[model samples]
Target: MSGVSGFDIFWLIFMIMMMQPILRQKFLEAARQRMIRKLEQKRKSRVILLVHRQETMSLLGFPIMRFIDVNDSEQVIRAIHMTDPDVPIDIILHTPGGLVLASLQIAKALKRHKAKTTAFVPHYAMSGGTLIALAADEIVMDEHAVLGPVDPQVGQFPAASLVKVRQTKPLDKIDDETLILADVAEKALNQMEYNLEELLNGRFPEEKVKELAKLLSQGRWTHDYPITFDEAKALGLPVSNNMPEEIYELMSLFPQPMRQQPSVEFAPSPRRTPPRGNGKSLI
Candidate 1:
């Protein structure tokens, strides 16, 4: 301090103070990059999560979990483009289902990718969700996990359900509106079969592929029917029952349905005498 000039010491202090925030930001950035690299190495692929559940928000003090659509084709396409084209990708899917067109867009993108793709279902993926899973080269699921029938839904109801109703009802009872719905349902089923066949072409033999498409598109099974790993394998799909251990760990991040808390009240403590004996009895 005696040897250094006053201006030199002040300048040194100023520089140190100025660098603090910059150093912190750099350190944080480096740590994030390291974590990403570690995750990629352990997972053996670039991982994406498609977790879908009813999300709610307050509207004038009323909470409602409205059905927000999941037509995220643009976002998915961007993610696909951003991912390394050479490496495999693992998509963790947990959706009940969504629009057919949206799901088809994602499926086509996955199919077009040069590298291998796998879908991991820790719980369930149904309807359109099943369609995307089918597009993957392989599917991994837990013993209890399920993939549901891929039959297209018309408006709010399953198209196959409409067709079934029309068939079972008496001719006199079936009205013009019913006839129209049945016709639309038939066309919807046909379009689904065609799309599925095109997707399954390179993966399976022509005959087997058509059979599988028929099974998926037709109303043979109910929309909510669960297709477990064994059933899926029996249907000639490339499925593996052995899900990765890390997948379970990843599932912990997803939100679960909230259970109603029990109505509990704490009892007030009873009044009690401090002691039985005293130094002197009251007169």
Candidate 2:
């Protein structure tokens, strides 16, 4: 047999390089499934994750933002349907929000589940993510995690602002397009408020439901305003700060697309304080 040529060696190296990413992805996926199984076994509940992150294309090296869409709603709803009615459900939400219609579909499906439903926010869940969180019977968040307002947006403008403009501006001064947008905005606002009320009705008192519905859907705050744990409690949401350690571990598995240099870094292990009166530090 002839000895391996230089060209053959180059081709072998090239093939291994190409296969590396595929093998890595498979390993990561297996690890995630194992984590999910462990969590389910520990909590005796079904686990569903609605995580959205920037996905980088391997060839183009461009990032694409993922969000809740019709496809996401379909898969989530299918998961809910496949689950037994008596089993509790835990939703791990991590998104900057997405389509209102898609979010509503997911919210309704989760609300219809017979057993208790919980939403866990390890970071921020804004806009439409907030809408889905509202449907859960309980919301569990990390101490520093945040939720956001669910105000409706029409195109690039807030529905509340559009409606305000139509009300304040003279009929002759307002353009036809502006008037049309205002009309649509009013309708969207009403629909959102109604749906929000419906989701919150049984969980809170009727008066409290109406108040929360109007407050969240009226665009009182900017779209991305972070509602901290204290604020959420003040607002009477059934939110708790007792987050599970497994949740943080699961989030680590869904790493953001790679970058040349990471923006933030810290020691991976937990820190412990030295014993009282001891001169030495504890590692």
Candidate 3:
């Protein structure tokens, strides 16, 4: 037999390099599934995850930002349908939010589930993500995790802002296009406020429900404002800071798409205190 040539070795190396990403992806998927199964067993609930992150394309290395969309809603709803009606459901949410229609669809489906539902936030669930979390009976978050306002956005302007412009500006000064957008903005605000009230209705006093709905949907804060754990509690949400350790472990598996150099780095293990008068410690 002829000995392998340098050209053959080069091709072999190239093939292995091409296969590496595929194999890594498969391994991550399997790890995530195993973690989900373990969580389900531990909590006796159906586990679902609605995680969105920027992922890089393997060929072009261009980053694509993910969000809640119709497809995501469909898959989540299907998962809920597959689950037994009596079984509790737990959804882990980590997203920067997405389409209002998709978020509402998910929220309504979760609301209709007969069994108790929980939303877990290891980092943040913002905008539309907050909308879905509100549908859950309980929201579990890491101490620093956050939820954001659900105020609707119309084009580049906030719906509430557009409505304010209509209210504060003279009709003669407003352009035809501005008037039209303001009209749409008014409708969007009203629809979002109504939806929020509906979600909070049975869970809180009628008056409190209305209050929360208005506060969340009326653009009282910036669209990206973070409502911390304490603030959420103050706002009368069903929020807690008892996040599970396993959740953090699972999130690690879904790392941000690789960059030439990572933006953040640290020792991966917890540090232990040294004994009195001793300098040595475990990490």
- TM-score of each candidate? 0.72, 0.94, 0.94
C-alpha lDDT score of every prediction, in listed order: 0.78, 0.92, 0.93
Per-residue lDDT value at 230 in model 2: 89
Instruction: Show where candidate 1 strays beyond 4 Å.
Output: 1-38, 55-70, 165-172, 262-283
Compared with the true structure, what per-residue lDDT tens digits does model 2 show for residues 194-219?
Answer: 99998997999999999999999998
Give candidates' CA RMSD values in order.
14.3, 2.0, 2.2
Task: List ranges where model 3 is wrong by over 4 Å.
Answer: 57-61, 275-283
- Taking the tens digit of each residue's C-alpha lDDT, what string does model 1 give over 68-184? 144466677678898888888887788888778888888888888889998889899988778889999999988888998888777777788888888899868989987887889
Of candidate 3, the 10-residue stretch with the lowest lDDT total is 54-63
Q: How far does residue 256 in candidate 2 sit from its true spot (Å)?
A: 1.1
What lDDT score goes with residue 30 in model 3?
95
Query: What total of clashing residue pairs does each candidate reach?
Result: 0, 0, 0
**Where in model 2 is the C-alpha error above 4 Å?**
57-62, 277-283
> Which residue pairs in model 3 clash with each other?
none
